[model samples]
Target: MEEQRALRPPWALVRGAGDGSGWPWRSTLLLTVFVQVGSHFAAHGQEGGRAGLDAFARVLLVLACGQLLWRLRRPVPVVFGTAGVTALYLGAGYPYGPVFLAVAVACFSAVVAGHRRAAWAAVGLLWAVHLLVAHWLYRWLPPSGDSAASWGQEAVIAAWVAAIVALAELARVRREQWERERAERAEAARRRADEERLRIARELHDVLAHSISVIHVQAGVGLALLDSDPEQARTALTTIKSASKEALGEVRQVLDTLRTPGDAPRAPAPGLDRLPELVEQAASAGLTVHLEGEAPRLPPGADLAAFRIVQEALTNVVRHSGSRHARVRLDPGDRTSLRLCIDDDGPATGADAGGGGNGLAGMRERAAALGGTIEAGPRPDGGFRVLAVLPLRGEEEVDR
Candidate 1:
């Protein structure tokens, strides 16, 4: 039920009361009826000296209520107008009753519309005028032998006005808090969406870059040996077919994440267990991969980050480096972190080779998401080196 209300538009609670369109006919009619009918009962109970409900008194009540039709449209003026009309009715010695309802509603609307000072000023003006008429001016104003009102009665009236203003102020504060919360929720949702998009982009880049690089190298070998060595050409074609099929499967798995998010993947993600496959792929691409130290066991997130870091580093070497020899080394650092380094020998080919410079960036993002880091640059000796240090435990554990 709470979710349903949150999903609804902000104005659903108020309907169109604050839309500033046609008059709020239903509310206006209700107020008019309440004041007109309730005033007669109030006058009947008042002391004999007060004036009865005359036609002029009824007209003043109607006029005060009528100003409420424009309260949401021009709140400041409506509040003051209602206060002035009600003050006049009181000064005429008419018995006080539901007639103040109009002034309360107008002031409430004004404060809620961010015209708080104006609402307070109008209420203050009405209170001051009532005090003057009830005390100093009542002798000359109405009820031929009327006496000044008691100070205790004046105090009660002041308290009533304070209560109404306090209620309006409370409502205004709550509305602002609701609006602020809604904005924060909206911003958080957008940020989550942006992060999801980036995650999918990195997944696609890693899957396609390594596989396509293998296919590119294999296709070249097949074409070069097609006329001279048919058997070797067949082997190259076989490698191409295998590389393309694996790429498609990985791409499908990535897409499945988008299609049904939050579900376990149909196939487990690649990790250091697939290092041999990466080495074979590199060998097929005419690059020799020399595996050094064994990788330590890591959590799923860190495992995937480590695998991708290695894959992207190898892909960069196959595409950008002229040297065919490369080395991959793993360092189980102090039992808390897993570190891996990829190094290639000799000068770079200066070729981006269809990997749009996102390879290194993707690797870095993967490492960072796992509370790890990536360092990649040209080595002082020759070629390039990529070093990634990922925590052995989960991100939550690492934080602790």
Candidate 2:
């Protein structure tokens, strides 16, 4: 795991740090003007440089001072140009003051532009040039115990400019670290939100789907048997009462899943153990369903998946295809997969709102949740088929 860096100060987080319009250039401009003027003082302050600059040296300073305002917009070019002019001034026996200012500004611009390596390269070059100018041209060194204040001044200015550049580099690094951490935290939050939404969608599918399908089938049963078998009709009425209560409990449980745990106990949901009830309910609704194979009770996730797929597929058979007969086949497919094939000998009449429906799509979604897949289309014998293969991580504890 990557450790997050401490957040940078607010002044750093505020964007637009180095735009041409930002304070960087404006501050650079002020410092540059001060440096250009100070160059003249430094030259005069030195031993035998000239009482004041020659006419041409003054002109170079004038031009460099003007160009310094756009340093952030064009850092590298400005530095190279200033360096060339400074070399020319040195060769002409002029002062190094304005040239040093230009080099410092150039380094600042590169760092602000996110050219960290380039910035360091510029720093090295500036230090090298300053040392060469001091040794070969000015015959200068830092003031030893031997009284040379001019030598000490040169050393002081060099240290000051280096410190400023170091601070700028620190600011750049801190800013980059801050941005990376902020982005990671936001991505984590987004992933968690997505997980919560998926869990809600699953609960909604399980509770609403199972309860509504149960209610619809039971209501159909009571109505169909009302004119035929009064005893069975009364039993269906009792079943409807039971289903409605179960639906209420399921709905309450689903709503409770949204609440904090200390609120209440959830009504435990049904699994494949309720397959007989589902089969009986389908029979009561006038469809003949045959169950085979001793199925092992599966993991809660796989069991819920099996139940939902069967429920959705059967609802689709009744609602979409004109199928009076449907066969459900569930057999263990080796050690890791359970295969479910529901074949309905019903003609596709192209009924129920011309094909876009919830039944098939819901089945597919449920299968996908368990890393399984479903395929539904016309079978070879001119009937519809719903085939699904679900993969499980563990074997069920019981066989029934």
Candidate 3:
């Protein structure tokens, strides 16, 4: 029992009745002691009765009430023990007192601990015993001819039992409701964790795929031109060096965001302001990219999404398209929307056209997340084209 008490959580004692600590047990024990000692004094001439309770009677009263200390953990057993002791006290013709209060408290603990039917059964048994004892007292002792007083006492006992049972049932209902709400909150937290993990996975995939593709192409070009064109070969080597460094920085940023505890410093996400750098890298990889209109003002999230979409599109051009030149156009579609278009000539023979992969799926997910739409397919002009229409209003609303 001591080991079990030590293993119990402090919160269980506070929130429920089963743990053997807190105000419930302390108050019960204090009330029992006070009532027992007060009754012993009342039985003396202080209450107009010269027949005082003997030492043995006082000891039995104390033992009966003390049994309630374990009421929360073994409520039913405590109820039976207290009831038996009270029967012995009453049979021995002792003074009537608060010794039976322990039985009521034990019954209440049983109900709060989710043994309603059993608690009701215990109450019935106690009521029967009380009636039988009252009958025995009426027969063995001389009647004072006061029938009203006897009936009144029985009514009071019945009322007390009803009140204790009602309060215990109410407490049980309230505790069940609390447990349900706690479960719902735990489920909501789990769903949020799942969503965050998926978002981080998408970010890592886009950043790594684009940067690594650029480095792979630049490395091949540097090796192929090392002997024939030393000057261009050196430029390819320079692009590879720069791309590798940037890739490492971005990868580190993503990892830090995931692993850091709280409020750690992080690099800012890429946006349209980095388009010029992207164009330069594409040029070094043997693709000429022509930039058009300026980017309109966008929310932070929309700006990052727009930059990734354009980056992925251009990366596909450098890897698959045989065309030396590609065109990128950005325009304000309306007061609340922006348009982006990228077109490149058909790929070289046997070069893999960007058809199906996580890249396209990731691009679509980003566009949809911001309430935008993207369309990509072969153009009538024998080239591949990607057109995206993104809403600025949704982003603005989210910012607000």
Candidate 4:
């Protein structure tokens, strides 16, 4: 596949400063050619016998050579165009040593400007014509080791082609390297973006998921008593107030954990080590969420994991089951495993009983990230169950 290149913006003056083929090379090549040809002509007493232009040809040659400056902005076309003009000048018997040098340089520029194959093809065609030029020049030299004409005729072509070609190839490799670095940077940025998004999603789940579930439970209790009993309604109102304040505090804690301030100490994440309060609060809300377990003290991550499971299950009960009874069971396994299960007898079957879709998905993702698994489904008799088996040790221990 052809790799896409990011084109640099054109300079205010140079149309394609980094595009096509630009600057010094074009002018430098033409300059090398110009100096040689103009000086040689002047040495031969041509053009009024000075090292400069003729009244008419001087203006034209200077201008034509100056056009080499624009080759990068227009590479292939300038090359062909210069070659055509040089061919005409050669036909007119005007010496063009400098123009040939300029043409070779332009071909090199074409390669660096991202036309490597095209430039080589062009060199081939130009060399074919150059061979004809060579044949004509060779005819004048006698066959001898020291004959000046023999070497001079071919020396410039070989030297100039090799030097410029080497530089062009170097430029090609550098361009490829630059392209690779740019792609790696973009990929890194994409991965970081994905990571940040997942982090925000987890935080939202932790903070709002529990609090909303609590509010829902309290709201239901309040609504049930609003008409039937005023004293009971007042108690529900107090519960709502207390729940809201606590929720706000938990929200603050979660935000603090998620954020890094210019200055602030980071607290640890809440875990099931503090589950006594969570259980007591749920009981106050009227559901008897009896929890039983001899589970070992889990890792910090697993502690939070177990806590969230129970919290979510209790929330589901108050919101969907319409039942005031639920059970949470946690048991330690041999070595490095802990099994936790939360079940509720509620509405038994309803839209709300199916689990909070987004919340459940987030929980599963958290478990997966922690290298564990969870299973959730409706129980056979009634209600729903969430069974999660979290490995609490090193991969080696867990595997064993």
Candidate 5:
């Protein structure tokens, strides 16, 4: 289920209401009008000998209620100040009616802003003051003829305070849970982005590395036969042109996938079905590529990885092994695995073979990512060989 944030007052903004700029001036104005009405009611509620707040005391009451404008941003301080001023108004023997509303609101704001400890402390202090005032009214002031009525008023006040604290605490817990859920979602997105980047890098390497290697060899062949054998040189030139054009087209396709909308049609990913074209390209590069055994149907990921592995191995043969002849063997091992091996005769002039480049490392990573393995090195029989084995079962596990 999707987690939802706690509901808050219209004036409340930002977690803990710490952003001063989001304070609601209009809402404060409305609250001020309400408190003013409450103050007037308190003034008119004066009993027999009890007196209402004088001008200075009435001003203090208005100021106490106005302080709620900052309660969300500064809950603890607002609660303390409101409570202190309300206590003074009551202690001055002024008539009591709605003056305690300001203190109650401040305490609720503190709890909603995640200041539970301070809110509870304010509640305790306010309760103590209420007790003291009740005792004073009972002992010093003449009773209003009904002692039960006085007790009932005190009970009602206590109930209101408890309700405010309970509701505010519930809101605070929900807000905190929502924040944690949002953070987790963001982290998951970051991880998926990183994985996508790695996948694109691997695809680009596979597409360009083999194509560039073929073009390199054909270019060399064209240069050598340019003067001596014009016809052969022309053929080599054609091969280079075709190889480069195909590489450019494939690279553009890969890039276009990034910009394409989800519903747009896209070309299928390269797989073992394209191995024949790869072999023909290698042969045009002056490498005699002999193939044996057809590839069986495989999972899309495994098919692509297998094709890239063979392409990289042959490219290495043309560029590093210095061999004119190479052999590719495919073994469809049972229903769960496929094996591939590519080997080339030793260098034409007995030169030391160059070490594996990024092509080899990329091939290894592709194999490993598919729960497969690749081994490439000089064979004991004076040739370079690459062997790869890919598992077909559980492709979904590898893809994720």
Candidate 6:
């Protein structure tokens, strides 16, 4: 069968037989030929003692091999069918040859298809019947002069069946393991995609929220003062233009990362180096921000996280607080961490600006990603404050 399979055209061999079921038509046909031809030779050795290859024995052989055609699909039925047909052939005292190959192939298919009990039952039934025929029923079976077979031969047959089942079980286990690994890898990829989407969402929210708040305030200021003060209104218009343009550039930068992921950023990510820009944008929004303490140096991730936390906090104040005065205090703590505080002296405007928004959530996500913490709430002294503490080290180093 193997040789005949190798002789076929490579494409035909790969495509296999009928309906793309991978049915081994060529192999089964070759096996039938081998069994018949092999039985002819085996008959010569058992001449005059065992029954020669006759019409009935040939029918049995063909029946056994034909059942194998359905082995890959209906393995349970095929195994039983082949086992019964092979038992009939043996009981007729036909010459032993490759006729058993059909049963072995069927058993293997059944076992590997996860029908172990069916395969075992078929094998056991075949063995039990063979035992009854070779010992107790030999006097009434074919080849009249034959004696009962030795127990030693039955032991050999039992071992051969054990080997076939064992090999098939091993193959089944390996296939299951490969399938599980592939599923786990697919699940991991989906998780990473979800995380990337969330990170992008947070980035867009931070950029748009801060810039739009500045524009909203400046637009309101320019309208109120337009008739009374042309110069201040014009200044407010200029601030709006600057804030909108910077927002577009940063937004474009964030989008570029999505288009060409894993590539280096075209512009640097926003960091504490951009803190002055945040303060300036806030001032343009009619919120006077007082800065305190020199900024601490930090790894890029922590720096970006710090900046976004401050940005979102200020945006929240602009939209929700009635206070015109805000304070930003930086604390470089212990050479290992950097602390940030954004405070607005309030009576809040009674606006739930970020209650339905991602602003505060995004801020917390950023700080947590850096092994840091964020605290934001109404202060005891009538104000709102957002406090963040981020590790000064790289995220990978912190993970270790």
Each candidate structure's TM-score, on Cα atoms with residue i matched to residue i, is: 0.90, 0.57, 0.74, 0.67, 0.76, 0.85
Ranking by TM-score: 1, 6, 5, 3, 4, 2
Candidate 3 local lDDT, residue 339: 89
Using TM-score as the measure, the top candidate is 1
Model 5 pairs whose backbones collide: none
Better of 4 and 5 by TM-score: 5
Model 6 CA lDDT for position 65: 89
What does candidate 2's lDDT look like per residue over 159-193, in tens digits?
A: 87678578667766876776788899899999988
Top candidate by lDDT: 1
Assess each prediction's global lDDT (C-alpha) against the native: 0.88, 0.65, 0.74, 0.63, 0.75, 0.84
Error of 5 at 17 (Å): 7.0
* Winner of 2 and 5 under lDDT: 5
RMSD of each: 2.8, 9.0, 5.5, 7.1, 5.1, 5.1
Candidate 3, which segments miss by more than 4 Å at Cα?
1-35, 38-105, 131-155, 259-266, 317-327, 341-356, 371-389, 393-400
Question: Once superposed on the true structure, which residue ranges of model 5 sit more than 4 Å away at CA?
Answer: 1-21, 33-62, 89-114, 136-163, 261-265, 345-356, 375-385, 393-400
Q: Number of clashing pairs, model 3?
A: 0
List the lowest-lDDT window of 10 residues for candidate 5: 1-10
- Residue 266 in candidate 3, Cα distance off native in Å: 4.2
Give the deviation of candidate 2 from the true structure as CA RMSD.
9.0
Off by over 4 Å in 6: 1-50, 54-59, 352-355, 397-400
